[model samples]
Target: MHFIHTNKSFLLISALIMAGLILQACGASPETTPQETPLAVQTELAGTEVSIVTHSFPASAISAQEARLSTIVMGTITMLDVNEGDRVSRGQVIARINDNQIRAQLMQIQAAKMQAAAGYELAAAAFRRITNLYEQESATRHELDEATAGYNMAKAQLEMLEASEQEVQEMLAYTVIRAPFEGVVSRKFMRAGDLAAPGQPVVTLSSPGLLKIRAHLPENLIRELTAGETIRYSVPAAGIEMDSVPLTRVNSSGDQMSRQFSAEAVLPDAHESGIRPGMFATLHLSISDEPAIFVPQSALVHRGQLTGLYAVTESGQAVLRWVRTGRAHEGRVEIVSGLRSGERYISVLDTPVRQGQRVSL
Candidate 1:
């Protein structure tokens, strides 16, 4: 017709210019000044007072005499002479054993004790010449009883080879191992050709000159423990701290399947506190302070296994709180429950926020 009515008026003016650019992009309005600016963060006002109320537990650092050492015979180690931390003392030999078959059976029992002291010195010179010829009557009472039975069988074969050369010199001093005290050789377990036997061990020692923490405590905190009181230990994995520590052993039996109670403590300068033995420690104890909550471990917030903190709410927003931590002192962290002290939280984040995220001061 007129070219199909002028192409249907150019398709109705390109569909009204795409609906007026979709209503001018739906009345435009999204620039939100950098997400409504607010994320400033870094707070902390979780108060609550009355401090002390301690009660820690989980201790360890023992060694009020460790030991181990072993080897009472059954040779072949041949001179190891102390090593693993070596300190040794009480007779300090430390290791030896291969005494060439106890020095060749102590040189064949000292050559049979020098042939039984030359046959007991020729049987005491023929029993003093047959008792001086039977007091001058010229011997023979059967030759003075056959020279007194050959001088009492050569003086009982030289006293049974001098008691078999003093039991082969005490089995050659059990091939020397020594050190039954002074300690510090934490552990060696045979090395110089290693063969050792009789009870195995070979070295472990310890004795940080009397240290001790040991803990277990729970028969309701062993009735507030005593033995000399003092308390407050800590080992934060060996950074060790002591402060009064004293409680020395409180065991009156209780562990019938861990009702607990096996205390210890005693750190009297733990031999200059190099600590030692097992290690872990904690202790503390005090008890009646109350009002807890604290916080600040950078306001926590771990999520995947929950341990939280972004809390800010009251409309400032942030909110992630899940809390429930305790006893981290100094850098703060006791919260013990879903947080409630003063409440603001969100300690110092510098960016990654989210849950209702708004944050500011």
Candidate 2:
């Protein structure tokens, strides 16, 4: 009990015990040999695959037959029978302008025509009387001449009035607007009661069934396209792709200002697929088909401004090799340079690694 109560003795005993533990740890050896397992990773051989390089240009779907429905006669729009998106047949009445003034003018012409006809009839009777009298030697030559001149003048006047009447009637026909072809109304600019003038459009009608793709190709690539050749196109918004669309037209004579030429392709199934005019489209012109090497995008490492990928050496070590990359497609990037065909490169990694680390396939 006295030995246990002494504080200096307890501290001295604790220090001696710690010193013995340290010495024993120093003298002991590992029971089983300590070993390092190689880091497991997957590897693949780099090789050339067929790569499709294309020059794509933005395009639009347009109606092959489009028209702006307008009236030649100026008047107030009295009737607009169709709205936007309304389907119309060829020669269908679309809109009408108030032709009350035209009708009034026509009535005035008709009255003048009647008066001229009455005068012509009277002149004809007088000329016939003069002819009979002159044949029977009962009239003077001067009187007959005067009667003949009056008949000719009256006949001319009557014919002139008839022409005027016809002119007014034709102008009346121009007040009614009609569709030139079967199509849908894309826009209605002048509604009912709106003032309409000549050359101003009342509605925009397009032949939706005759839809085609129109694109402006740059001058550099215009030589590669030709008429009657089938090309591939896509409507990204509609998720539609066409591979065998027949090219209807291509103009290599590039525009002077824009330095581009126009191209058009027939869309045979555009109506069925709900592709309408003014919808966006893309035209794909295949540039080349050659073997190009590609690397997995996941394996690319970016250290500041430099990009590198891990490659395996013959001695089974990971060496970080800097690579110049091109465009990325799908899940892989194009190896423009710094990598060769049939070379070994690291793929997806499970654990982070460093340069000179051992990798086992």
Q: Please provide the root mean square deviation of candidate 1 (C-alpha atoms, Å).
A: 19.2
Best by TM-score: 2
User: For candidate 2, lDDT tens digit of each residue in 23-117?
Assistant: 99999996997665667888889998776667788999999989988888899999897989999999999988999999999999999999999
TM-score of each: 0.32, 0.64
Clashing pairs in 2: none
Candidate 2 lDDT = 0.88
All candidates' lDDT scores? 0.78, 0.88
Best of the candidates, lDDT: 2
| CA deviation > 4 Å runs, candidate 2 | 1-53, 251-255, 287-361
Runs in model 1 deviating more than 4 A are 1-60, 68-96, 121-125, 139-164, 171-173, 176-186, 194-202, 205-211, 214-246, 249-276, 282-361
171-248, model 1: which lDDT tens digit per residue? 778778788788788878778888888888888888777878788878876776768867788776556665666687
Model 2 residue 359 distance off true place after TM-score fit, in angstroms: 26
